[model samples]
Target: MSKIDFLVIESDAARAESVVAALQFLGYHPQRGEECLVAEESTHAWRAVYVGGVADAAEAERQFALLGAAAAQVPLLAAADSPWAARLGAAGSPFAQRMATIAFPLRYEALAEAMRGLYARLLGSRRGELRFVGESAPMARVNALIRQVAPFDSSVLVLGESGTGKEMVARTIHECSPRRDKPFVAINCGAIPAELLESELFGHEKGAFTGAISARKGRFELAEGGTLFLDEIGDMSLPMQVKLLRVLQERVFERVGGTRSQRCDVRIIAATHRNLEQAIAEGRFREDLYYRLSVFPLELPALRERLDDLPVLIDEFNQRLARRGLSCVRFGASALQALAGYPWPGNVRELSNLVERLAILYPQGEVRAADLPEKYRGQPQPEETRGAALLAMMDARAPAAAVAPAPAPAHDATLLPEGGIDLKDHLADIEVGLIRQALDATGGVVAHAAKLLRMQRTTLVEKLRKYGMQGSLAA
Candidate 1:
């Protein structure tokens, strides 16, 4: 395996050495530099970047933008004073969108935690092209289908709600298939006008229509030896569906205003959020075309259905925000629980948007339940008793004007007990306690509990097996 590397842009001698030493201890090779030139020298080797030692907010902003351009998609972490973070937050510079800011004098443990999370996020994004991140039963079924069908050249119909990442599923299929090296062209069938959809799908001859001054290759020709993704296929008009069905059947199509048929050596992956079966029953969609498209069907569950993947999804969104130069944010326990309990009607897309919004608004704050919008702050129906307890606590407290919210707890320096304790055993016990709480809160649903603890289902399962706690939850 290749060694992981990091770019350290710091001018503070002691601080720079401290950061480098910590990175080395974590098994990552840290390359140090005073400017952004280091980014250009070893781009691919650096998995992440650390920005420090700026004179003020203005200098930090200018240097961040320069490094951002050099490092493109790599995640960045900045160590700065609280005043600097506050300045950046108020000024609303681009750095607030792309870098995770760690205030000065923080414990090494906190820094390590932040670095690990950022690195994992970057690694996951790099791996996302080939794998979809989820371990729930629904996702497992989808993976199984992909494994079974990827070797064959068959029409795949992917059905899911909008914002459920239909295009990602299509891309995953293409990556898993035999034609992985070839071009994968995607077009939204519903986005284009019905009048021009044909010319877009099938190449247009020179002077084919009013605007056809030059010949052009359509999605099919562009896809050549790989896969063609027809998104929102259910919204495709009947005439266009007929044309597509004929192409699927004959394995060839003629350019618009041209007579000669062109061979199509492309795999078809069509996705739609609409109910095509109902459309067929209503006579709006062709039954023959439905048969042709659904040779193999895959359905992706909505965000609510697969809530177990929320933690990973949030991490993925944070990585995207970091690429844009935003500070990473964390969800408090109450906030995370609230998020998990809420019904995500807009699916993964909505969740991503919300995370990005938080990154922009809060920048570097820990989000609490109260920090969320009104609609999302309320507890779900199943947690009514917990909500009642919270209400009771509120009522028991002093007047609102006399009360103040508690400050976040600070990480204390490591201390040894006079009566020595087994550090490993103590940590193991804490982990067990947290896992038990998660399991109880999730009603012993291992996958849900795994999400609650921000752990992969398989990892949780292994722990459960080791502890002989598998009987606690029915798989």
Candidate 2:
């Protein structure tokens, strides 16, 4: 194991010595509070902060705060006897909520277990703009590859299924590289028409073609001294591939319909969902271009291939939603089990969409297997069986007197009248009434109203459209 840096903030000499000894035994480098404070200007990121034997809560808070931003990014581990441990474990403060408490005497076994969990969490947090939120073996390998290739300016070819975050990997490489201060320009080769792609990549001079009214800088010039991400490179036409190949080889490109060759100093990072090798065999892609682009190949695994990462990914997505002022949602055990069983054809993107939709539908609610969409609830037990099991479990936990008898059916459950009724219209009317109430309660905010009714915003919008109530409601 590598030597992880830990900041130890303890006032008692004996306790501080014991803490440092245990950290060294666990193969971690421990820096004293005074030492860390003196080296505050250093750009070192501590893996965790150890708080033990502080005089009181006030002194502990002051010393912890003094560690500054370096301490803020990492985990906090407090001893059981530490004066501030109780306050740090309280619910109000966000930082305190995440702090871990250890044994007072600092038993190695307990300390190791706490450290293990925190280390895994620390690994999943942000690394620059790279939010690689997974600790699975596949993701660990991907992160290792990124670290190895980021220092060099070699061409990287990222391969993954659609929605598997190929472009994210490309951006991570750029963000981790030495040229991160420069711009990162991206162009989707497949999205642009063949005629316009050349001008999009290599700028056209003023009046060079029909619509070339003004000269514009292309992606190569825009990404000078940084990275140019060519997405869906497999879709580039044969002629365009030839032109791109020339630029890759010579590091120079001539604008469309221009004689002057402009030198480019940009790193090339290309990605595609298609199999370039298959495209080459089919004679649809240039083999030479493929080789040039794949100097360092990085492949991202589909979400289904790494199910262990589901929980972390969901938490990261919820944090993102919360940062945007949207409500965060939590999934119950059964809901998570159902989600794990799902085959995510759309990969990470689909999961992200589901989280956002759930945030809109459930708000700060705990979602169960039944609450999930039908497609996601894989092979769930019948409602009758589930209800019986739930009742049995409740009976086992609660006293006989505490369990109330079932209530009688309500007035709304009365039999239909003799006159034939339009069941569809009746149901539609009930839905409209509920929607109107939810809308009114939320002051016409569709998203908030959707949460109140436990439905998606888009679903509510469609209902409003079908009822011809769009004009009356504020969207």
Number of clashes found in candidate 1: 6
lDDT per residue, candidate 2, 248-332, as tens digits?
A: 9999998887899899999999999998999999999999999999999999999999999999999988876653346788886
How do the predictions measure up, each by TM-score? 0.58, 0.57
Please provide the root mean square deviation of candidate 2 (C-alpha atoms, Å). 19.3
Please give the clash total of every predicted structure, in order: 6, 0
The true-versus-predicted C-alpha distance at residue 194 of model 1, in Å, is 0.5
Clashing pairs for model 2 are none
Runs in model 1 lying further than 4 Å from the true structure: 1-130, 380-475
Range of the 10 consecutive residues with the lowest summed lDDT in candidate 1: 380-389
TM-score of 2: 0.57
Top-lDDT structure, candidate number: 2
Candidate 1, residues 1-475, lDDT tens digits: the string is: 3333577767677888888888787777776654444244224255577777765656555555444444565666777653455554344664443456776664464476466435433443432244676777888888888777877899999999989988877877776777765666789999999999999999899998999998877879878898989999988999898999999999999999899989989999999999998999999899999999899999999889988888888987886666444668777655676788888889999999899887766664456554577677664322232233333334323576655453322332145657765566445444554565566666788887777566899999998766445555755
Candidate 1 Cα lDDT to native:
0.72
